[model samples]
Each structure stands twice: as C-alpha cells, then as structure tokens.
Target: MKIHMLPTGDEVHRYQKSIVIPFKNSRKVLSTSPLNGGYRENLLSAFNHDSNPGAGISCSLRTDSYLNDLKLLATEIGLDPATATGISTAASMDNVAIKAVSYENLTVTAIVTGGVEVNGGRVGDPASYHEARGKTVMTKEGTINIILDIDADLLPGTLARALVTCTEAKTAALQELMAGSSYSRGLATGSGTDGTIIIANSQSDLKLTYAGKHSKLGELIGLAVKPAVKEALFLQTGLSPKSQHSMLRRLKRFGITEDGIWNKHGVLGEKTLAKPVFIQQLESVDREEELVALTSLYVHLLDQMDWELITPGRAAQEGRYLVERIKQKYQLDVEYTFSWQSAEETITGMLANFTDVIARISAGGPDV
Candidate 1:
C-alpha cells in the first residue's frame, strides 16, 4: 500500500481534519469482493491511537506498529497483490482520507472525501466462484473518499464502524452502477486497496455538505442501533415486547412519534393496557346475543306501544331499520373506534350504552 503525504491543516476547520490512505492495486486484474485487510485496518485505525508524535488531525497519527498491522491485515485477507488495499504507494501512495468533526451535541461527523464513482467501481473480472486468487494480477490504483457523521461519542472502533457504513454505502452504490444507473458505470474495475495509507488530519472544518438532503451514514447508524435501544426501553417497562401493532399503539398513546423524543408519558403512568384486568371486558361481544336480545326487546316494546302515535307502519319499519343498522354496522364501528383508542374504555362505554337502551326499552319508555 502507498503512504500518502501528511495532509495540511488548511483543508479543514479547527473542529475537523483530514488524512489520506494510499493503496497499491493491480493493473491486470482487480478483485470484486471485500478487502479483508482493508476492511479490518479501517476499523482499527478508527479506534487506534497515533504511533508517533500526535498530529492535529483526528486520525492522521500512525506508528510503525500501525503500519505493520496493515501489512499483517493484508495477509489475513490473503488476497494477492492484485486485490488487497496495500500498505505503500511505490510504489506510489494510494491515499484516501476519512475526516471527522465533533458537533455541539453528542455527535461526530465522519466524511469519506471521494464519492461513488471512485469508491464503488469494480476491479477484477469474476474469479471462478470456487477458485483461489489468481496467480498474478495487473496493477492500477485510485482513491475513493467516503464521509459519515456519527451521532455518538468516540467509542472504541467508532472509526471502524464509520468505515463499515461507508462500505455498505459503496456496495449500494455499486448495485446502482451495475444496474446502469450511476455515473461511475463502465469506467473503473475495482476499489483500490493495495499499497494504501489512510491519513486523517485534525478536524477544523465546521459545516457539512452532502449531495443528498440527509446524511446516509446517520441513517445506517440509526438502523444499526435502533433495535437495541428499543429492546432496552421495552425491558425497562417490565412488559414483554408485544406485537408491532400493540407496541405502536402504546407508543402513540404515550405521545411517542418521529417528531423526536419527548417524555410525553410523564415520568411514569399506569400502563392500563399492560395489565390483563380489562382483557375479558374487552373480549369481543357475542354478536348473536346482542341480536337476539335486541330483537326480542323490540317485539316486547311493539306489544306495549300505542299504534295511534305517528303511523305505526312507518314507525315500525324505521325502528327495525335503526336496529339492523346498529346491529350490523354502527355499533361495531363505535366499538372499533373506541377499541383503537383504548380497548378498556371502549368496552366499558359500549356496555353501559347498550344496557341503558335495553333498560329503557324494557320499561316501555317513549319509542322516540
């Protein structure tokens, strides 16, 4: 792999810096798969400290050991000189920079300087899927700069995680390129990893600019950690995680949404639905019982009704129509609407209303 020149501070802000990792690659055949060495080194460099006098850049500092580790990493991938992101350049330096900047809140920005065209391009023709690395490969080399803004502390291997996110983005970009949709299409053969050195300068750059509106890196980071956060939150509540439907309903009722975290649920509240107290009450009504009881009550009321009032035929017809509508649709809709809000409350209100009507009808109250 190549060792690129140390980056000048002027390229970034006080809060940001950049470094380049130079790579040596084969001119004859570029491998199309992951670089075992490159992938692993990037992860370590992200977390490892500087070997010599510390440079102002966040990641530029490298020691003899770090460099040796790179060489060793290449061996681990065990790719021929044609495929690995090598250690030195000329060899010439295969330099690429991964810059990071800390923001006001709990966040850090990791930027891979180059774009899709450089990073996502392919290298070698397909080796036999089951075959070993080629005897010898041609040599060509280039750089792809990737960027990311991490929303957390400088945890160990954070830099490596950022690199992984970059790899993912590159793969996605490659897919689009293969499908004939990217500008990088038909130009490059593979990502250069041979004889490469990464230089990270002290961070001085402040603002972030990207082609897309949102940081694709942040999205990946969120996806990586969201499940764990969710599980932790759910466990704290002492409720076994439920189906997504129930979970979302609970979150919504607790005022949780994409708008951002808010303790809208207060410090804590009674998780009524979390308990089984109302499960039986909310059990679906016996539709046949509702129908039979209403129908019999209607007949009894008719026997006691005064036919002289408001044209009995029309009145009876309208009454029957209202009963059918309630039985077939309106009552069901009301129950659903309430159930969605809170099954307990919906059932309680429903039963109370039904009972009131039944009592009034049994007492021979006004048909109106």
Candidate 2:
C-alpha cells in the first residue's frame, strides 16, 4: 500500500517496520487427550480461546475405538493380572508341574498334574510321589503312573505380577492413543521503511527503516515500536537550548547518525523538544499536510504475517499437499509431525489397568 508524505520540517527521523505472525493451523493428525485428564483444558488455554474470538473451538478425543484395541491386546496371552501372577510365581518356585490355582473363599488350591497329594498319607514320607501323597485308586488318576499334586508353602506371587502386566499393557495402549493427535507450524514476517516525520528546522523527511526482517504473529500479538523524532531546527533558529539539548539527548538515546544534510529519521529530544515545526507547518498549510502531521508523529505499522497454514480436519491429506507445494516451489522441506490420544483411549487404558491382571497356568509333568 502506498502512503503520501507531507512536509514535516527541515529535520526528520524514521523507524524500521516489522511484521509478526502468531498462529498457524496444522495439517498433521493429532491425538485427542482424555476428557478427565484436563488435557483439553490445557490445549484450550494455550490457544486463548476465550479471549480471542477468531480462535476456533476445542476438539475432543476418539476413545471407544482406542479402548477396544487395548482390550484386545490385554487378552492376547489369556493372562489377566491374577493368572499371570500365579503362573509366574509357580515357575519361580520350581514347582515345575503346576497347572492352575483356583481360589474358593479363603482357600487356594494348587492344581498339579504329575504330583501326589501333600497332607494325605504322604507327608514327610518317601512315598510314591515327592512332597505329596500319590493319588490312589478311584481318585481320578491319569496314566497309571501314580502322580501327586500339592500346594507349595508359599503361593504364587499373583498380585504383583498381575499389577505389573496390566500397568504395562495399559501404558502401551495410552501411548498408542496419544500418538493419534499433536502438531505445530512456522510463521512468516517482513521488514522495511515506512512513513515520514519532520525533525528540527532542517526540513528533512524522517523515514523508519529496519536492519533486517522480523516476524510477528501474522496477526497483532502485540506492538513494540518506538516513535520517530524530528531535530528542532528552531534550536538553531531560536534560543531554546533546553529544546536543543533534549533533541540532542534523544538523538544519542536512539543512536541516530547524521548524514551531514539532514536526519532521514526524526530528531530526538530530552523532553519537549521545541514545537514540532513540521507539524506546525502542516497545520498552516493544506488539509493534506495536516493529515501527514497526524500520522508522521509516531512510528507506523503494517499487519502481522504467518507462514503456517493449520486448519482443522484431514490433516494427513492437507499435510501432504502443503509439503509437496512447499518442496516443489521453494524447495523447502516444510514437514512436521504431531500425535495425540483420544478421550476414550486414555480413560479406557487407565480403567483396564484398574480392572484386570494376568493369570498364570503351569502344566505339570516334565519340562515339555
């Protein structure tokens, strides 16, 4: 956009323009967080949804499907936490032939295949079986090889093993859920000189210039620019050492350089650096000059710029398109990844841990 500059004064000052871009939409698939975990709260607060009208609404996680997957994995080994604990404990105890442990009220029975009974007529005796009484006639004996099954003094470490397995399985499921949603993008910016101000009686046009380009929120995240000054030529014309000193001080403060002729930027002042001659002149001149006086008194700003383009929806598809376009045109690899867990998956995983455990079953007989 082109802007007209009117006469400010013999002396003038300028400022550099900068651009900022704050938000950008992402095209990557992100997992939603559980409703109860307050992940949604965190996301909404980050975007400042309440304060900013443009900011979109909050999104929710997809849980049912995710939980189903967790359930499937949990039952994969036919080992609930309870069963797993029993089997693991049995294995550790060297009770090589243990098959199952059933709990009835306060009593727990260890089922063995190739062992004799423990309490019956075989306790402490070099009976047919070791550490147990052999099953006798009519006792449902398998294979005429008199076998004995007995419970160990210490039961299987069922509780601990079951807890560990369930916790581990649930955690894995949670991760999978989260991996489904998370994202980020880049910002764009610009820089240059804009507008003019009159400083002093030098009749120089002030210009704002930037050493380099700066990026802001594409929208106004905030504004941070200093006003341009005008050297008071009146200091030289009239006897206002106070004004001259102030102007000089301002020049020093802004680190303004003199190019012999006039400061292209505004002149600095300590406090009230003499009447703004350019503005005064414009007031006396035409309507156009008056307009310049109003705008040229301070630093001018454009708008914010953003490099990212994140909108809601088909993230993968949009991401592919964005990446391809960026690579093809700018030869830039504008690729980013995001992941998130759904509300259902997150809660379900936690519930699964709370509800189930592994069950251990040991087959009696030889190592086979």
TM-score of each: 0.24, 0.12
Q: Rate the local accuracy (lDDT) of all candidates.
A: 0.30, 0.18
Candidate 1 per-residue lDDT over residues 1-368, each given as its tens digit:
22222222112211112232222211111111233343222221221111112223222213244344434444444433233343321111112233333325333333222222212234442332342542322221123323233333232243444444445544443332221111221222224432222222223232222212155434544343223222322322221223221312222212222221111111123223222322222222212344444543443233223223333444344445545554453233222112213333332333333433332222221221
Off by over 4 Å in 1: 1-103, 107-125, 128-139, 143-161, 171-217, 220-368
Give the least accurate 10-residue stretch of model 1, judged by summed lDDT.
24-33
> Tens digits of per-residue lDDT for model 2 on 1-368?
11212122111111111010111221111111111111111111000000111224222212243233223322342323211111000000111121122222111111111111111121122223332453321111100010011111111222222222222322232222111111111000100101110011111122112111131110000110100000111111221223222222122212221221022212221112223533233223222332223212210110011111322223323433433442343233223332325423322332222111100000110111
Candidate 2: C-alpha RMSD after superposition? 41.8
Q: What TM-score quantifies how close candidate 2 is to the native fold?
A: 0.12
Native-referenced Cα lDDT, model 1 = 0.30
Q: Which predicted model would earn the best TM-score? A: 1
